[model samples]
Target: MQTRTYNHVDYLWDDTKAASLENDEVALFLYRSNILGSDLRITNYGGGNTSCKTIEKDPLSNKEVEVMWVKGSGGDIGTLTRQGIAGLYTERLRNLKNVYRGLEHEDEMVGLFNHCLFDLDSKAPSIDTPLHGLLPFKHIDHLHPDALIAIAATKNSKKITREIWGDTMGWVPWQRPGFDLGLQLEKCLKENPGIRGIVLESHGLFTWGDSSYECYLNSLEVIEIASEYIEGHVKKNGKVFGGQKLESLPSGKRIEQAAKLAPILRGLCSSENNMIGHFTDEERVLEFINSNDLEKLAPLGTSCPDHFLRTKIKPLVLSLDKEESLDNFNATVQILQPQFEDYRNDYKEYYEGCKHSNSPAVRDPNPVVIIYPGVGMFTFAKNKQTARVASEFYINAINVMRGAEAISTYVALPRQEAFDIEYWLLEEAKLQRMPKEKPLSRKIAIITGAAGGIGKAIAEKLVAEGANVVMTDVNQEALKETTKSMGKDEAIQTICDVTNTTSIEKMFDLSCLNFGGVDVVIHSAGLAISKPLEETTMTDWQLLQDVLVKGQFLLAQFGSDIMKKQGLGGNMVNIASKNGLVAGPNNVGYGTAKAAQLHMTRLLAAELGADKIRVNTVNPDGVIVGSKIWEGEWAEGRAKAYGVSVDELPSHYAKRNLLNEIILPEDVANAVFSLVAILDKSTGNTINVDGGMANAFVR
Candidate 1:
C-alpha cells in the first residue's frame, strides 16, 4: 500500500495562536477550508460545520467563560469569510451533556445553546452545532470526508473501525443526524471517557483539540489513518487484466469536452461542479472495459453520498468504438427503468412501514450511477470540486469492494437503507440550501473551427458554463491536438470539412450517435479572401460561398432536422463577420458571402421557427491574433491596407470599437451561448459582438 505522512496538518495547526495566531494559521484555515470545500469531502456550500472554542471573560460575571464559534448554517465554505463564523456559548452545551433522554424536538434544545452574534444578519446555527458543542476539546472540526465515509459505508464498518482506529476512537452507526446523533455520542462518551474523537458510520469524522490548529490536525490525522487502513486491507489488488497499453490522452480537447460534459452530468445529478475523472491506466481501463459484469457493476452506489452529487451513480463506460459504447450506455440507462421502478416501489413500501402519514415522499428513484464501458467513472457534485472529491472516493470504494469480494462475498448496503440515506432529510435540506444552476445539463453542442482562437475560447467558455461541446476544425491534426488539451470524455474532436455535405452529415450523425442529441450549433468555420471587386474571380466567390453560405445552410439543415426529431426546441448561432452587415473596401467575395450568411440566418430562423428552432448571428469586427483569418497571410494584407503595422492592428481595431478593447472569442461565445441557451424570445436578430466597429465609418 502507498502511504505518505502529512506533517502539513501539524504545521497548519502550529501556526495558529488564538489571538497570537500567526498569519500562517489564518491562511492554513482558509486554505484547508477552501480545499475541503472544493473537494466536497468536508463541506458542500454550507453543509458540514466546524468550530473553535476559546475562553473569554464575561464582563458582568467577572469570570472566564468557555465560548465556541461554529460555522453559520447558510454560508458556503468556498466563499467563506471570517465574519461567516458564529459565536456560540460553549459552557451551556457542556452543561446539557448528561440530559439526553427527554429531548423531543430540536427547537426545544436551541434555548440551551448561546451565541454572541458578530452580525445580526447571519442565519441560524448549524444543525450539527450540538455535536460540536458537546465535544470536550477547545477546537472541533467535522467533515463528510469521502475517504472515511467509504470505509464507514460498508457492512462491516464497525468492525473495520475497531480494526483501524482501535481504542482511540468510538464508532456510531448510521442514525438520523442532528440531536439523535449527538445524544448517541453523549452515551458513548459516558461509557468511553478517554475517546479522543468519534466516527459517525456512513456519515463523517469529528475530532477536537485545545486549538483550531490542533483540531484540524487531529481531523487530518484520523482521516489519513483511515485512508491508510483501507489502502492496506481493503484496496483492490492485481493488475487490470487485458493487454491494452495506457497512453495519455491530449489535454486541451479533453478539457474542453470535460468542461462541456461536466455541466450536463451536473444537471442530471441535480448538482453543479460534479466531478468527472478519466482513467487510461492499462489495468484499470482493461478491467472496466473487459469486465463481463459491466451491467451488474454499473448500478452500484458511489463511495459516498456526495460522490453521487458529482459523478451521479455511474459513468458513461466507453469502448474503442464510441458509437457502440454510447448505444450500450443508453441501453444500460434504459434497462434500469424497470429496476428503478421496482426500487421505487420497494422504497414506498419501506416508507409505509416506517413513516407516519405526515412524512414526505421519497425523491426521484433514477439510478445515479452510469457506466461507460471503456471510460472512467464520473461522480456528480454541486460543483467541479465536489465531483472530483466523489470521484476520489469512488476510486477508493471500487478498490475496497474488489478487495472485500476477494476476501468474501461483497454485500452492499441494504436497498432500504441506501434509499433512506439518499433521501435523508438532512441531505435534502443541504440541496435546498445550495444555489440553483443553469438548466442545460447533458445538452450537447458542436462548434466548427474550434481550433481557431475564437473557436477555442467559445468552446472553453461554453463548457465552463455547463454545455458538452464537440469542437471541430478542418485541420485534422490540429483538431486532435487541441482536443488533447481539453478533457477526453466531455469534449470530442472531429476533422470536419464543413463545405462538404457528406463530412458535415457524418459529423452530425456521429455527435447524435455518441451523445444523445445536439442542442446548440455554432458555425464559425469560414474562409476570408479580400480582393478588389474587379479582380475577384468566380472561383473565389464559390469557395467563400461554399464555406460561409453553403456550409451554414447544411449545418442549419442537419441541426434543425435533429432538433425537430428530438421534439425539443434548439438554437443555432452563426458566426458572421461585421463585413456581412456593412461593406468594406476591396472585400468582394468575403463580404458577399458573409452577407449571404446573414440572409440565410433570417431564412433559416423563419423556416425553423415552427420547429422551435432559433437562429441568430454574432457579427464580430476586427481580426485579432487568434482568429484564423488574422493568424495567416491575411494579417499582412489587412495591416498594410489599414496603414499600420500588424502589432498595432489590435489596438487600432479596439479604438474603432465603442468599448475600446479588443473583442475576444469568449465575448462572441458568450453572446452565442446567451442566444442559444437563454434567449427564447429573440430570434432572427444580428447581435453585434464588435467593440463598436460596426458604427465606426472610418478606422
Candidate 2:
C-alpha cells in the first residue's frame, strides 16, 4: 500500500520547499494542498479541502491551543492563499458534537462553525469543515481523486477496496456530508484502529497523518494504489464503455461541427440567463461520447456530488448519427429543438417530484453539459471559465465511469439524495451571496480593426461591461499588443482581412470556438482620404470601398447567420463618419464609402428586423486625438485644404464645429455602446459623436 513511485499521479512534494517552511505548519499545509490540487487526476477546481491542526496562542487567554486551518468555502486548493483558509478552534469544533441534535439539524452546525473560529477575520468555513475538524490527525486531505472515486463509485467498491488495501483503508457507506458523516468517519476510524485512511463510498477518499509530509505521502500512496488497481482491471477488461458504437469524426470535421452547433446550444441553454460556452474534443471525451453505453449511462448521471453539482444531474445527449453532417444547420436545429424542450420538461418533472415544501424554486431547467456522438462535448455557463471547468468535471466523471465499468458496474447517486444536495439551503445562500453580474455579462462581441483607436476603445468598453470579445485587425503586432492586457476570458485577438472571405470565416470560427457565439458586432475598420476629385484616382476610390464598404458587408452577412441560428436577437453597429451626410470640400472617395456604410446599416436593420437583430451607425467627426486615420496623409491633406499646419488641424477642426469641441476615440465608443446596450428600441438610426455638426444633421 505504501507505493513510493506513482504511475497515475505525480509525487510533487519538494523536500527543499518543505524545509523552507521550517516550523510554519500552515505554510506546509497550503503547499501540500497546492501540489495535490495541481493534478486534476487528484482533485478538481473547488472540489477538495486540505487542513492541518496547528498550535496557536489564544488571543484572549494567551495560552496555546490547537487551531484547524482548512480551505474556506468557494476556494480552490490549487490557488488557495492564506486569506482563503479558515482557522477554527479544534477543541470547540469537537465540543459541538455533544449538542448535535441529529441529521435533521445538520445545517445549523454550519452556522455554529463561526463561533468556533480561532480568528474572527478568517474566511467562511465550508460545510465540510466538520469532516476535517472532528478528525484527531494533525493533517487531513479530503479529495475527490478520479482514481479513488473510480473505486468508490462502483457497486462492489467495498470488495474492491478490501482487495486493494486490505485493513489499511476502511470503508464508510454513502451519506450526505454533514456532522453525521463526520461522526460516521470517527466511528469507522475507532473500529478499524489499524486503518490509515477511509474511502467514503460513492463520495471520495479521506487520508491523514500526524505530520504534513506523512499526510501528503499517505494521500498519494492511497490514490496510486487505487489507480494502479483500476488500470490493471481496465487493461484486463480490454475495450471500455461496452466498446465504442460511433466513430469519431476527423479533427477538422469535428471542429467544423462544434462551431456550427455551439451557437445553437448556447442560445437554447441561455433560456434562463445568457450563457458563455466552451467546446472540448479531448480524446477521453470523444471515447465516452462514441461509446455504446453513453446514452444508457449518461442518463444515470455522474456518481460524485461534486461532479453532478457542476455538470448537472445529467447531460443532454444528442442523437446525431455519425454519417450525418451539420451542413444543414436549419435541419439540425429542427431535429434538436424538440429534444431541448423535452429536456426542460423532464428537469421540471424531476424538480416537482423531488421538491420539499420549503425547497428553493427550480434552477435553470436546461442542461449544463451536452454531448454529440461524432463531434464532442459542449458546456455552457454564465462565463467562459465556469463553462470550461464544467467541461473538465464532466471529463472527470467520464474517467470515473470508465474505471468503474472496468472493475464493476458504475453506479450514480440516488435521485432523491442528489436533489437534496442540489437544493440545499447552504448552497442557495452561497449563490445569493455572489456579486451581481455586469451589464453585458454573458454577451460576446466581435470588433473589426480592433488594433486601431476607435475599435480598440469599443473593445475595451464592451469587455469592461463583461462581454467576451474577438478582436480582429490586419496589423498582427498591434492586435496582439492591444489585447495584451485583456484576459483570455475577456478577449482574444487574431489577424483578419475584412476583404478576404477565408480570413473572415476563420475569425468567426475562432470566436465560436472561444466564446460560444456572437451577440454583438461592431464594424469600425475604416480609413480616410481628403483630396480634390481631380487629384483622386479610381484606385483610391476602389481601395476605400474595398476596406470600408465591402468589409462591413461581409461581417454583417456572416455574423447575421450565427445570430439567426441562435434565435437570439443581436446588435450590429457600423462606425461611419460625419462626412457621409455632410457634403465637404475635397472629400469624395472617403465620403462615398461612409455613405455606403450608413445605407448598409439601414438595410441590415430593415432586413433583420423579424429576427430581432438591431443595426445602427455611429458617426464621429474630427477625432484628432487617438485616431489612427489622423496619423496619416488625410490629416496633412485636410490641414493644407484649410490653410493650417498639420499640428494645428486639431484646434482648427474643433473651432470649426458649432460647439468648438474635439472628439476622441472613446467618444465614438460611447455612442456605439449606447446603441448596442442602451438604445434597444432604436435601430436604423445614426448617433453623431461629432461636436454639433450642423451640416451632418439627419434632416
What are the TM-scores, per candidate, against the unseen true structure?
Answer: 0.67, 0.96
> Residue 553's C-alpha lDDT in candidate 1?
89
Kindly list the per-residue Cα lDDT of model 2 for residues 157-200, writing each as its tens digit: 89989999988999999999888999999999899997999999
Least lDDT summed over 10 consecutive residues: which range in candidate 1?
A: 271-280
Cα RMSDs of all predictions?
7.8, 2.1
Residue-by-residue lDDT tens digits, candidate 1, 1-699: 113466322223322333453433433454445555664434444446676666666766778887666676656655665667666656666666555445346444554443444234544666677787766666666776645665666668778778777888888877645666777887887777777788776566777776455566677778777656555543454332212334333444333333333223323433222222222223443355445554455456454444444344344443332222222334533543454455446545655665544445654433233333343344433333443344455554454344344333334444455555555555566678666665555567899999877788778877777666788888887777677766644678888988898898768755653454577899988767877778778998899999889889899987776665455667898999888877677787898888898889999889888988889988888857577788655666677767789888898888877778878777887888788767878889888888776452322
RMSD of 2: 2.1
- Using TM-score as the measure, the top candidate is 2
Candidate 2 residue 277 C-alpha distance from true site, Å: 1.5
